[model samples]
Target: MKKRVKQPTADVPALDDDGPFAGDRQFVGALYRGLEILRCFRPTDGPLGNQELSQRCGLPKPTVSRLTYTLSKLGYLVYLEDSGKYRIGVPVLGLGYACLGGLRIRDTAQPYMDELARHAGSGVLVGLGGRDDLSMIYVACARASSVVSLQLDVGSRISLARSSMGRAYLAGADEAERTSLLQQIRAKVGEEHWPRHEEEILRAIEQVRTRGFCTNIGEWQTEVNSVAVPLRTPRHEMPALAFNCGGPAYLLSRERLEQDLGPRLAEMARKIQTFGST
Candidate 1:
């Protein structure tokens, strides 16, 4: 077995406590910190130690140790003896699955998304995603391209400021939420690169307003092209969601996305939202 290499425990920024609820007296800091520890594990991460968790979460190692111990005992994290690290436990998976299961739109939208993808052509993929902090996490997926499609699945995440799906979501979000998310994105990207991302995001919002869909052609990835539309959730409190049809640039030309798939995806969103509300 390949030996696990632990990342250096320096230079990681601490968790920002500037959220809207930071000043709320009712907010449980310990509970929030524990959840933040869970959020640090991404789809591609390996088991993490207290040192890494401390750096990632901006918590002291001792705090992380206590949190990890509590989480491990609670079955939210599993400690590994060999690596001296923790991986997300089965109970967390159960919670995720339970959340997904409650989103009725996933079932109501899949058939329509699949049909739309087929009409878009081979190599194309259809995805339904919702905001996950600074990213959009796919909650449902469909593909028409049997042989080759974007290497994404239900749990894959894409950049919220770059992806068409995420931009559509931004367009659909309430003004306050959108402003907060943009501020977070600006902080993440830094002042040096914020202007370009801001421009692209603004343009996407305009496209959605005028044309009912947004396109990301060779922007998020140099060779990928996609079109997306905002989707309405059944409840107001739910996070904003979007649907995207995308694939390799060579297979999905800008004209085709703009003139064909984009409108169809928007129509699909309309129908699904109608069904979802009832």
Candidate 2:
């Protein structure tokens, strides 16, 4: 057998390359690096050491150490003596809660989402879309039955390749932005597992574009099913936000989610958008 070394593809870039932001002066490298470090701490993650953070962020170990120390001192991150590692501190939660508190959409969407969730016996969520790897974050979530959905709320992150909310977002994005995000997803998930997801993601986005909504049937999680629609806010922010309705797979099967609940979600999205404009 012959040995082969796979080279990096131009489409999938290294973390340090800066890619599109190469010479954008207003883009502060240091601040971006710090935020990147903060984002590395997922709600599911345990305390992480500097070495792990360095590898995850693709930054030098020394830089990660300094950044971690600074974050710790600022109360944005905290060190654990037993673990000899750091975890997200209370201040980060304050920041996320603060942002959610001021969001006009969150306030506007809650009542409707609660009503919808009650009727559908499912979960309804509003997600903010972004170009970043964890592409969407839950801003408002309403669950009628805790037993029917996972415990996710404001600040919960979801992958762009798997969630119905993410597909709706991608369907609403411009071509260049979509391509860039797909490339980032490929780089993050790696080549071996990207193809299967890539095919399904494209198909779902196409469906979203044609039908004005999207669906996920046991894609992100085998026990989950969901449908979503993009909301065009007055601001028209890039990678505009999405609204989703989802629940336990047994209760929110593909047929039910796509056929019955999907249009309801899409309607809710429109109403929310209208509210945002007003």
Candidate 3:
């Protein structure tokens, strides 16, 4: 048997890839690199060293070191003495809180999400998310009263290709952005595995067009089932977000998702959009 070698993927794209802003004179590369380093830290990550940060951000180790040091000095990152690593600090939390605070939709959507979660009964979780790179990041979440509910919470990231929430977002995206995002997902998953993901996404998008929502059954997580609807905002700057209702397969059956909760969520999204406009 031969050992397998991993291929390069889009998750670690080069920092200097020329894009639409490549020729812009006002773009600050240093600031961009510093922000990229901060963005690499996930909700579940522990304090990370320069080597790990370099790998995640696709920057040279020396570059990551300088950026991390600057960030630490600015109080955006805190250095761990024993581990010789850096963790997101208090300033980052203030930024995150401020960002969330500015999103008035989270407040508007939470009550509806909670009602839907309860309507779907225990073991069901409802969430609202937006695209973050190749993943969907939960901005708000609600779970029915149950110790058995999924452990996901605000800031959790899930698959952008296989999750119902992600498919819903793709369905709502403009043609150019959708194409670009799908290509990025394919690049991240590699060519050999892309066909299956592409097929799933296409089917879900079709569902969103014909019906009001899309579903995922045993796709992202083998035992999780979900349905989602896209939420196009009145404000153009906000981009589109998505809402999902899902839980363990035993609790959320395919029939229930497609017939009951999916339609309900779609209706909720419609109401929210209408309210936002007025």
Candidate 4:
């Protein structure tokens, strides 16, 4: 039987002691909630109604309805008049591409991703994590085989606590930043599910810090395995890019991952960083 996927709770708390409205209460809440609603549409074709969105987000129907209407007015969402549904609009696409154009790491990482995919017969991805947050944004992706059903794609965002790509970025972050992010993740996810194995997680981070690469097996998704390394720019001391390769679990067992793929991914990160410099 397939393992049950853990669902996020409805009333997850804010990341700090100051509560949800710590900074710019009303405006920030609206902006955050609106973005959350938008993020829920990914990995699927969605033009969800108010009820569907409310259920998905565990937010009130009235709140979702208001947010949807407001987003539609702001040109971030489009209402299908005949179908009575809503979809992400042109503005979001425009802004997404605009953001992509500004990231130096994405440009440098794509060629390496292509090379990795070609050589390994697996999918490669590059992700950028928020400076003050633990979430990762998948910036670029290259795939070799169409048979694999990896849920991630370019422009996707994932929680740091649940993904190896995100954890790799976290591992490379400075001590203060890493601690703050871990605290934030714990607050958002609650203590029970936030740290799967505290000792193991810390040991992995330490190993990544030493070897400059990370590996995982069935951490994010059951029967999916991956390895990642941090990419640093010449000007910065810390990582600006996170590169990963993912494939079926059986093909990427723990022993082979540590013995073979780990070094290969680290080498790819170094090459990508060099390319970024020139």
Q: Give the Cα error of residue 101 in candidate 2, in Å.
A: 2.9
Write the residue-wise lDDT of candidate 1 on 88-160 in tens digits.
9999989989989888789999999889877877889999999888889999998875788899998888999
TM-score of each: 0.89, 0.84, 0.90, 0.78
Model 2 Cα shift for residue 80 (angstroms): 3.1
Tens-digit lDDT track for model 2 on 179-250? 988888888889999999798888888888788788888888888888888777667532267788776777
> Would you give me the overall lDDT of model 1?
0.87
Task: Please state the error at residue 249 of candidate 3 in Å.
Answer: 0.5
Query: What lDDT tens digits, residue by residue, belong to model 3 across residues 1-278?
Result: 22111244455445454433687777767788888899989888998888899899888776677778889899999988778788999999898788789778888888888888889998898999989888898899998789898788888898889899999999999999999999998888999999999999999999999999999999989999999999987686565899998899998899999889989999999999887666
Better of 3 and 4 by lDDT: 3
| lDDT for 207 (candidate 4) | 68
Model 4 bad stretches (over 4 Å): 1-29, 55-59, 122-134, 149-151, 195-197, 234-239
What lDDT tens digits, residue by residue, belong to model 4 across residues 150-227? 667876766566667777777777789778777777777777875564554576687688877778788878898877
1 or 3, greater by TM-score: 3
Model 1 lowest lDDT segment of ten: 1-10
Least accurate 10 contiguous residues by lDDT in model 3: 1-10
Q: Sorted by TM-score, highest first, which candidate order results? A: 3, 1, 2, 4
* Residue pairs with clashing backbones, model 3: none
User: Which scores better on lDDT, 1 or 3?
Assistant: 1
Report the Cα lDDT for candidate 2.
0.75
| Per-candidate clashes, comma-separated | 0, 0, 0, 0
- The lDDT per prediction is 0.87, 0.75, 0.87, 0.69
Q: Candidate 1 vs candidate 2: which has greater lDDT?
A: 1
